[model samples]
Target: MAKEKIVLAYSGGLDTSVILKWLKETYDAEIIAFTADIGQKDELDGLEAKALSTGASKVYIDDLREEFARDFIYPMFQSGALYEGQYLLGTSIARPLIAKRMVEIARAEGATAIAHGATGKGNDQVRFELTAAALAPELGVIAPWRMDEFREQFPGRAEMIAYAEKHNIPVQASAAKPYSTDRNLLHISFESGMLEDPWFDPSATSNEEMYVLSVSPEEAPDQAEYVELEFEQGNCVGVNGEAMIPLEIMEKLNELGGKHGVGRVDMVENRFVGMKSRGVYETPGGTILFAAHRKMESLTMDREVMNLRDSLNARYSSLVYNGFWFAPERLALQALVTESQKNVSGTVRVKLYKGNVIGAGVKSHVSLYNPDIATMEADPTKAYNQNDATGFIRLNALRLKVASGVEQNAKK
Candidate 1:
């Protein structure tokens, strides 16, 4: 009889390394480790070798930076998807893509099961499983953190660390670093440990130690810097007069935004699992892009159309935040957002100063703003007729006058 094969979404981190070994032993299965590269930087170093030596039949490291930025980040940004009106959906948006690729690998490798290191309490377990259920319902999901047996064997980080040492599993996690971090092209998010306290002040040290994408606002340069962003159909195409692809654009913006201390958000958000979780995110490029995109849309979008899109923004944001990236409603909302962005093409200039993204100017050849009609000094174009106000106001006030008459009659 052949050994059962299981595909593991491996990060080459402490938790995953232990899970890789544990899964293999528990199920008596051949473990195939898969790591998705979405701008995790040095985290991918020696991952294949580590997985192989740590006891894995096969190791697959995929570079999905282009697909991630272009497919996932751009569409979410186009929808103005922001969780709880604050979080940029950094970690939330990355889950579906990871799960999608995991499913693809599972099918290609002829694996019977897929496993992840996401905990039982967090949103990622839902994101991963929901995606798997939607895409590959036949594949079994083995979540060790959710299993009581696994939890009993390894209840805390110290137990996992000891087990790793005893089993000769090399891991990056340690007791010294209290919090855990998740990183991708869009942003780096930190949670757990001291960050769990809502009232905890990361500003004490400006959180320079934990933050990877940007410097602290206090540590930013004294002088403000101006940046110009070019957009086409609501997608940022270039920065500072240079044309670049999505991946390149994100890299450059990360550099620029990080230098200026532009994007750092710390908030206590309501999780889909009905618990409040505190998160600190560093999203330099995304912050700059969102501000520039809003400015571009303001110049080119119709008022009513923009209002409708604005109303859908929260709903669209919730869909993504709740791991509904593959849901039908999210697709419908995406279609509407894409339609709304057709004319949102322009250049927006912004000044970045000590965490502030202040808009300087915006322009588009297809802009709906009419200087002549809106000028307060005088309408030399004769576009405005002062006589028009009389009938317009009286007609608008007719209902108000009728309501007043009724109230007066009742009072009498």
Candidate 2:
């Protein structure tokens, strides 16, 4: 009988690399290693060779940068979803996309199971498994970190390192840095290690080694910089009047935002598995986009509609954070979010200075801002009638007056 085929979500990192070898030895399965390239910069360098050398039967690396920004990031941004009112949902958002692609690969390769390196204690395991279950219910999901056999054999990173050494596997991990990191186009996140302490400040070092996408606010240039963003139906399409593709737009914004030290967040966030984790994130471009997008919406969106969407922002963000990206509820909410963006086309000017993304100006052709009626200066031919306010105030105040009278009667 042929050995079972397993598709592994390989990141070329120490954990996933060790998992790849362990899976082969324990399951006696053929491992097809998969890596999703979502703008991790130099992290993808030599990944293919490394996977192939580490007992992978085949190595697949796909560049999903454009799809990631256009499909996942933009729709989530449209909802203005922020996990726990702070995190950009960078790591949370990427999991679904990775899982979706892994499922497709599994089906194509006739694989029976998909494996991930997410630890049992962390949220990524839930994210990866939920997505796989939603997309491919028949496929078996394997989590090495959750397996007792795997844990007993390799209790910690030290044992894993020793195993790698014994098996002659090449790994870049070292005891010097005990933290884990996840990176993509939107942001780079650091957790564990010294960052595990909520009060620990990574910026104490002059190098600011923890940050990959932006500089420290104190180290940023003294002068502020301005940039213009153009949006069409709530999607950022151009930067500084230059029309660019989704990937190019992110690249440019990341550069500009990073130079000005924009988009750095540190917080202890609630994980879906009921634990608090301290994370430091650098989301330079995403910060600019979020600020500029909201500014543009202020001019173009209807008041009531904006309020309704804002009310659901927390629910929408929780759905994303909890690995429900492919859930029907999330899709339904996304549809409403998309519908709300139909009129959200405009330009927003932003000032970037010392980790701040400040909106300078916003304009839209379909703007509801009627300056003629709203002007403070008296206009003889203003559209708004001054006499209209008397009746409006009287009618609105009647309910309050009646309630007061009822209260006085009860007291008597």
Candidate 3:
């Protein structure tokens, strides 16, 4: 009988490289390492050679950038989903797509099980497993972090490093730089090292070499530069009036926003596991998208509808943050959000300078902003209903009048 095979999501990182080697030894089964290139352009370099050298029977590196941006990013963008008030839900949205593909590869390769390096404590574990549960219920999930045997053998990063050394498995990182980081096209997250301290100010030190995706805000251009974002059904289609594809639009916005230091956030956020964790994120294009989409909604969406959705946006964000992406309630909220964006087709001009995204103007074919009804210059005689104010005010003030009458009677 053929040995049972497990397809592991490999990143060629320390944990994953060690996991790849450990899985083969412990399971005594064929291990196929898979890497998804979802906009982690430079990070994917040498992944194939690294996986193979780390004791993988086979390696697959799939570039899911276009699909990532178009399918996952665009739909979340449509919902205007922000994990917190500040976070753009970057990591939350990428997991399902990657896991979906993982299941696909598992079936294609005849692998009985799929594995990931996500630790049991983090949101990634939930995201990956929930997606697997949703998409491929039949495939067994091998999460080494949750396994007692794996944890006993490799208690932490130090143990993993020792095991890697003992097994001759090559890892790009050492025990010195022990910070855990996840990167993709949408954004990159840094956590679990020197960052665990809540009071740790990432911006306090002038570590010019450490910053990526943007320059220091002090170095941003003095003058604000305006860019127009065009969207159709909430999916960004163009920048500054020139039509472009999804990835192209993102690249353009990142270039423009990063040049102006438009997207950089550091916060201590509540993790799904009831623990608060500090994170530093740079979401240049996503920042631009949020600004432009908000401006567009201000002009296009109905006041009550917008208010209703805005009220629920926090709950929606909490669901996404808490790893409820596959939940039915989230889907229902998403459907409502999608319905809200049907009229959210428009262009919004934003001024970016020194990390500030100011709304300059907004225009949409579906816009509810009627200049005729709003303009101060409009003729007062015909459209104005100044005479109706007396009855309107009297009716509105009845409750107050009744309360005042009762007070007056008591005083008398």
lDDT of 3 at 62: 91
Candidate 1 residues 219-244, lDDT tens each? 99999999999999988999999999
Error of 2 at 225 (Å): 1.0
TM-score of 1: 0.96
The lDDT values for all models are 0.92, 0.92, 0.83
Positional deviation of 329 in candidate 2, in angstroms? 0.7
Worst 10 residues of 3 by lDDT: 202-211
Better of 1 and 3 by TM-score: 1
Please tell me which model should have the higher TM-score, number 2 or number 3: 2
- Candidate 1 has an lDDT of 0.92
Query: Per-residue lDDT of 152-208 in model 3, one digit per residue for the tens?
Result: 988777787788888787776754554666777777777777778867666665444
Question: What lDDT tens digits, residue by residue, belong to model 2 across residues 91-186?
Answer: 999999999999999999999999999998888999999999999999999998888998999898889889889988888888667788899999
User: How badly does each model clash, as a count of residue pairs?
Assistant: 0, 0, 0
Question: What TM-scores do the predictions have?
Answer: 0.96, 0.97, 0.92
Worst 10 residues of 2 by lDDT: 202-211
